[model samples]
Target: MAYVDGFVIPVKVGDRQAFIDHARQMDAIMIEEGALRIVECWADDVPEGKQTDFHRSVDRQEGETVCFSWIEWPDKATRDAAFARMGQNEVMMKTPMPFDGKRMIFGGFEPIVLLEKANG
Candidate 1:
């Protein structure tokens, strides 16, 4: 089964390009470190909810946009090992995040099922 690490971050609207640039660098590093793939999604149609929502979960403020991202790994063991390695990498440790780290939400997931459409 594939292991995944997902993230939701609130980034200033004006910093969108900067965030993308940052992600590109980070993605390259993760790929080099054994991540199968890196995906980054900018919220396009995220809706506000009365109870709880992506915006509320991240305590999003005006002039900010929500970003959804994930890293896919071959397995849990691989993911764990890569994370440990990343912690020790100087570039990974020193790179500045474009968004507020305190407000970001992230977790590792064990996928129960994954389906993909066949390509013709």
Candidate 2:
């Protein structure tokens, strides 16, 4: 089973490239620290909801876009240990985030079900 850390963030439209560059730097650190894989996705068809939605969830502003990302680890223990080691990691501490950290939403999840097709 994999332990996953998920994030939804609000980034300024003008900072898309900056965010990708930043993710590349930070994601490498996570991989070195033990993350099995990481994925960063930009919004394409997110629709506004009458009551609530991804945009509202992160308080996304008029010129911002929502990004969904995740880090996968072999297990919770590995994830926890890796994060612990990254506390005060020099590169992580120095890399600047292109989004508003205050509006980011993140959580750790234990998958309840997963299905995958075998690759040819």
Candidate 3:
């Protein structure tokens, strides 16, 4: 029963290198803040429907693709405490953000089931 912070954001097209750099910085901050693991992903194969049909999201003047990322914390309390320090985190404050954070969709998820942790 760990805590998970999930997010889906839009990055500038053709800026893969910059995105990776940004993630590297973000990784450190998350780890320092007690994150167990961070998983960042780009929309390799988005399912067809409202997702691919997103209207006026972060971008997609003519319907572009998207990416997602998440961080795993020991528990909800840890996650909450860590996020509370975001305003004062030096790395979080110094790192350059490529996308508009306001436009991103993010939140905490209570996993109904985690298979990886289940198998002994």
Candidate 4:
């Protein structure tokens, strides 16, 4: 089964383009380090909930937006190796993230279910 690393990030609403640019750079590094695919999504219709929500989960501020992202790997071992390699990557070390890294939430997951449409 494939492995996945998921993330919920809090980004400044005004830095949308900067965030994309940063993701583009960092995502390429992830790919080079062995990630199979990278998907980054900006908030569109996120709603405020009384108890909890995506925004509350990440402690999003008034001027920030929630971003959902994921990285796919062939397997857990590959993902682990890639992460180790990324830790020493020069570009990754030099590039600065546009969002507040401290507020970002991330975790590795083994998918329980996955579905895709036929290519037809």
The whole-model C-alpha lDDT of candidate 2 against the native structure comes to: 0.94
Candidate 4 residue runs with Cα over 4 Å from true position: none
Clashes of each: 0, 0, 0, 0
> For candidate 3, what is the lDDT?
0.76
Candidate 1: stretches off by over 4 Å: none
- Which tens-of-lDDT digit does each residue in 57-113 have in candidate 1? 999999999999999999989989989999998888999999998999999999998
Model 3, runs deviating above 4 Å: 48-59, 62-64, 117-120
TM-score of 3: 0.81
**lDDT (CA) per prediction:** 0.93, 0.94, 0.76, 0.94
TM-score of 2: 0.96
**Tens digits of per-residue lDDT for model 3, 6-47:** 877876666667777899888888788899999888677756
Off by over 4 Å in 2: none
Residue pairs in collision within model 2: none
Report lDDT (Cα) of residue 2, candidate 3. 87
Check candidate 4 and list the clashing pairs. none
**Model 1 RMSD, rounded to 1 decimal:** 0.9
